[model samples]
Target: MMNKLYIGNLSPAVTAEDLRQLFGDRKLPLAGQVLLKSGYAFVDYPDQNWAIRAIETLSGKVELHGKIMEVDYSVSKKLRSRRIQIRNIPPHLQWEVLDGLLAQYGTVENVEQVNTDTETAVVNVTYATREEAKIAIEKLSGHQFENYSFKISYIPDEEFVGAIIGKEGLTIKNITKQTQSRVDIHRKENSGAAEKPVTIHATPEGTSEACRMILEIMQKEADETKLAEEIPLKILAHNGLVGRLIGKEGRNLKKIEHETGTKITISSLQDLSIYNPERTITVKGTVEACASAEIEIMKKLREAFENDMLAVNQQANLIPGLNLSALGIFSTGLSVLPPPAGPRGAPPAPPYHPFATHSGYFSSLYPPHQFSPFPHHHSYPEQEIVNLFIPTQAVGAIIGKKGAHIKQLARFAGASIKIAPAEGPDVSERMVIITGPPEAQFKAQGRIFGKLKEENFFNPKEEVKLEAHIRVPSSTAGRVIGKGGKTVNELQNLTSAEVIVPRDQTPDENEEVIVRIIGHFFASQTAQRKIREIVQQVKQQEQKYPQGVASQRSK
Candidate 1:
């Protein structure tokens, strides 16, 4: 059987297309075209689940031009085994209407409408129990006395409705899942009334806890709403109610919903009632949830309410709003609002504290005192000092390839200058020292440092150990060594650097002379260069002859 439902009291503006589009958007395939009657329409869904969800969600809600909507199962087409006769049916209604209404509960075997001969066409209708006709009878009871009336000869437990449905239709599904017991919920706007009962049927065991759980879930879902809380909890109360519960900008209703995990709506009248009349704040949620929100909101509101009430009463007793106002009220009776916090939670810095004047001494972190007058003594000033180290090679550069650079730099900076000798065997290594005020020393150092660094006078050198061998005829040896080494003494004077020659016949080589240059890195390099020049000259001048005496110099 199709799960056809009836929708009624739609706005005149509502069209069949609007209804079709709503279901289409939900992805519900329409089993049949919507039958749009004057103020109502019938929709058939593929199954019972969609029908139940639709009823649970949209029942009693207004849509389409502010018209309240009503939904219910369609009448059955088959006959029933048992049913009470319901007559005086609306003339506008037809036998098809009865068939659609009773069919939702069980198999509807028959529906017959008996009409009077009167031109008004008042009539009687009968349905079989096989259709679970009792459900149709109950739902129609209140409605029949008015537009539609019912005479129920049998009664079904109201709670049994939910039991028959199952959890979100699970109970119904279990019986119908395999065998096809499609249960549909056609809810009308009058569901809250005792006379307007929900219908149910399918497998005999169809009515179970499944419906109860599902109905509970639906009701809970419909009731819950939420919002974020801001502002101090203390100021939330108004007229003795917690003000925060009202919410910043009147969102307290939202807070109650969120806190209780249930939906709550506050009527505009109820909001005014909080302060003017009843002074009660209504909250909705799960039983426990609502209670929690209620306590908190009420406590806050009460505190604020009481304080305000006290203030008003006191003002009336002490200071009249009209009549001659006392100057005392304007002056001493006012209370000031507290000031906001300072930057970064810090107190303002204290004003500058000037130390008491004293000629003897002064000491402080700020505005340090001038030096005290006392007997003159030698001591370095309390200021920064920059020590400079110059390489020996750079010393000559600072001296300016001569001594002129040092003299000029010293005069420019008002600094005393001392330059040490160039590093060499005959000359002691030199150093230029500058001492003066920081400013003067800094200027002098800058000039000297910049010149030396830019010129890059320091050159890298390699240390090479050398062994020179000389061969001399045995005959010429005695002559070269002249009485008591007079000739060697002259050679020693000729070269400032050390010179050593092996003296005895036991020596391995025929003859050899070794010289070593020891000085600063650059000085040693220069000395080596000079020694090489001298050696080259001697080699050119002195010529060897086999078993011969010294040769004369050749041009």
Candidate 2:
């Protein structure tokens, strides 16, 4: 039974005098000096019963400078050092819920909420042993608590990461699968961090397994890399004479192999090409075996080279344009041949087009138009049109207060933009039509994309698809879509894009409805700009002269 009481979550402003006064107020006798540290403090009572009384009365009931204090026995350094830090706890969560959750693992000595922020809190939970703390981390890290996900990590020495990662991430993948933990090894970069942080999110059993596996993998990789440097040899050989060197029934190769006691293998056939037509032979053995094998291979190759030269005159065109000196048929070395050229007078292949290759939005919206949006225009810049699907919730932001935002966007982008009526009652999306020249298209569509992101329709990390929709009044739908679809047709022709105003839709809360827009980024932008221009024109006409007429009546 420890008599020393550990009071944590202390206000940084707390002092020894404050603790002394609090004890005096309770009429409790203090045995010795009060030790105060940043965010924590310790004071000993005369006996265990007094410490218990102090804990029972003061724990969480007393507030010092608006923060509740936590009281517990002062744990030994060995036990305290083994604690784990758990972060990203939701602020609204009560301490009882967290205490019960952590207590499931082991005897939790103390749970101190250290750093509290507007969004979440960071808690330092100390257990009776390091093993208990580790178990809590594995089981609870990454566990979703209400809206927040837990993040748990441990600081590790910088040198150990290389071994844990192994070659090409094999070791780490194995550990992750075996231990059922997501292990992240964050190494030092330009930021100059002193030690790497190794984070493992797993259950208690998994966490233990992961730690054990990581240490073993690291040790094994270090040993292998060290040993590989001690002995290795690589040799190059031509494809044509390698069969002769191998000999009939492999007898010549067998003799060399038996004598040198080295395992040898030629490179794969796929490695041979017109440029080099050679393969690598790797020999692995003791230094003495490798030396002896090299001597035997050279003797065989020299004889083959001499015989090849004698037969060269007999077969002049045996290999068309074959250069003996370049092929190392002579006693010298091998050289690379230039790549073979295509047969005479073949037409050059066409250049690659990126848009054509990509599927989805780019393919459907921008499909191979004769007029290019980029520079080098031959005639009046071709009009490009685009359609976008905007979510119903985002319609208000795009339309703005009384269509001011849309009018401003059209003027800025120099494009026409309109929102067609909704397709039906069940349809959650609407269409936006934009039509303009290429530059106008770019400006309009870019703003729309920015607006969606700003409004948080989707997360920033997610890819923003080109399609969007908007809503417009059923009365204004006629002017936007136009008679017999003529206005919509001209809109598409002017912008060289697609515009669709679906028939018959139920009205939303404001008696307005959904319209759809579908096209590549620029075309959709252009069509949106053009439609907004029309809508703004109608709005100006409706408000114009009314004020003047009223003034005339007053006169």
In model 1, the Cα lDDT at residue 359 comes to 10
Q: Count the backbone clashes (under 3 Å) in each candidate.
A: 54, 44
Instruction: Give me the runs in candidate 2 sitting further than 4 Å from their true place.
Output: 1-373, 379-387, 396-427, 431-436, 446-555
- Model 2 lDDT per residue over 269-347, tens place: 6644322234445555655665566557645754664454343323211222223222111222211110011111221
Q: Give the RMSD in angstroms, all C-alphas superposed, for model 1.
A: 44.1
Best by lDDT: 2
TM-score of 2: 0.24
Model 1, range 1-555, lDDT digits (tens) per residue? 134465767777888888877667756546455767667776655334455445434546536668877764433221111433343355666656655766666665434443334222322233333345556656765455344444332211122233335458676566446433344443332221111123323232332222223333333322331111110011111222334446687676676566667543332333222111112233334435543543444444434544544432332121112111111111001000100111111221111110100111111110111211212222324232223445555666777746787888778766787764555654423445556653354355546544543453422121111112233444344434445766444444433323333455543264433333332222222233333333434544454443233442211
TM-score of each: 0.19, 0.24
Task: Tell me how far candidate 2 lies from the true structure as C-alpha RMSD in angstroms.
Answer: 28.5
